[model samples]
Target: MIRTIDVHKSFNEQEVLKGVTTEFFPGKTNLIIGRSGAGKTVLLKILVGLVTPTTGDIFYGDVNFSQLNKKEMRAIRMKVGMLFQGSALFDSMSVEENIRFPLDMFTSMTWKEKAMQVDSCLERVSLGQVHKKYPSEISGGMQKRVGIARAIVLNPEYLFCDEPNSGLDPKTAIVIDELIRDITIDKNITTVINTHDMNSVMEIGDNIVLIHEGKLAWRGDKSQVLESTNDTLQQFIFASPFLQRLRAAALERSQEG
Candidate 1:
């Protein structure tokens, strides 16, 4: 599991996060969601060591990540896996090379061992046949799958995904969401996702953190979202009239049931 203890961050006096505290359970999809400018991005970056918190602490299990030096942080990072918003695959590299990048960079394993590992990860993401294709040759959803395969190539203990469903059709998006959740459960990885996709929330959000203006406004699972009485959560989640109507209908059904 991963957790934050009253963590805060600021840049030139503009505070981005304000004493946010929460725990993200392992073997589940922990979602950080909010409207734009709500500070969810900052918090995700802070958790991944891309940004530093001005105050308080962050913990990956028992170790205090907040106090780690560069070297210490590097050691901890070896167990981390990140899937970028853009799928961040190298344009020039084949799918196999992209998935093998981490192993090649960090390990002294022979070529055969690296190939086997790459093949295993490809199969895990159901992209074993696309190993030789370039990112441009595959569909956007396939690219996302390749990114996921690369993220898990190291068998990371903590997986971070920033908008895994971005740029895909709704059906493809659901597939990606289900794939992420399945992998999280299978690997028992502490999975944290930075997303604003409500579909993703309803589908795979085992733990959802809603941030508002730099603070943690609410935290709950998908099942509690429709019934939640928290105003901040309600406003952010049901901003559209169509969704508001949907929520009302859902509530009515629940009452009848």
Candidate 2:
């Protein structure tokens, strides 16, 4: 599990995160969601140790992550996995090579051992035969799966995903969502996702925190979203006419029952 205590960040003189505190539970999808420039991205960066918070503490289990030295941070990072927004696969590398990159860097495992681990992760992501293909040769959804396979190659205890469904069609997005959710539960990893996708919020958001203007405005699970009357959450969630109508219908049904 990951916990943040009064996390605050600033750039020069402009503050991005304002005393944000939250906890991301294990074996569930913990989502950081908000509008553009709402500081959610900065918070994610801080959580991943890419950026330092001006005044706050980040905890990975009982260890103070923000106070760790380079060597200590490296040790912790070995057990952490990240799925980038763009899939971030090397164009020149085949899927197998990409998945095996971490093992090659972090372990003394033999080539055969690495290959077996890579194949296992690929099969877990349901992309068994794409090992020889380059990133350019696969569909966008396939590329995302490849990224996921790479992220889990180390069997990480903490998984951080930044916009996992960024560019896929609605159907493909749902598939990716379910895949991530299933993996999180199966591995009992502490999964943190930074996303603005409403479908993702309503579908896989086991724990959702809404950041608005640099602070956490609300927190709840998917089941509580529609029934929530918080103005910030309502405004952000029901922004689209379609979603507003859907919420209306849901409320009407609830009233009848």
lDDT per prediction? 0.93, 0.94
Among all windows of ten consecutive residues in candidate 2, which has the lowest summed lDDT?
A: 122-131
lDDT of 2 by residue, 1-257 (tens): 99999999989999999999999999999999999999998998898899989999999999999999989998999989999999999998999999999999889999899999998999999887898999999999999999999999999999999989898999999999999999999999999999989999999999999999999999999999988989999999999999899999999999999
Candidate 2 residue pairs that clash: none
Clash number for every model? 0, 0
Over all chains combined, what TM-score does candidate 1 have? 0.97
- In candidate 1, how many Å is residue 237 off? 1.3
Give the true-structure RMSD of model 1. Answer: 1.1
Task: Please give the range of 10 consecutive residues that has the lowest summed lDDT in model 1.
Answer: 122-131
Tell me the tens digit of each residue's lDDT in model 1 across 1-257. Answer: 99899999999979989899999998999999999998998999999999999998999999999899999999999999999999999998999999999999999999999999998888888776898899999999999999999999889999999988889999999988999999999999999999989899888989999999999999999999988999999998899999999999989998999
Off by over 4 Å in 2: none
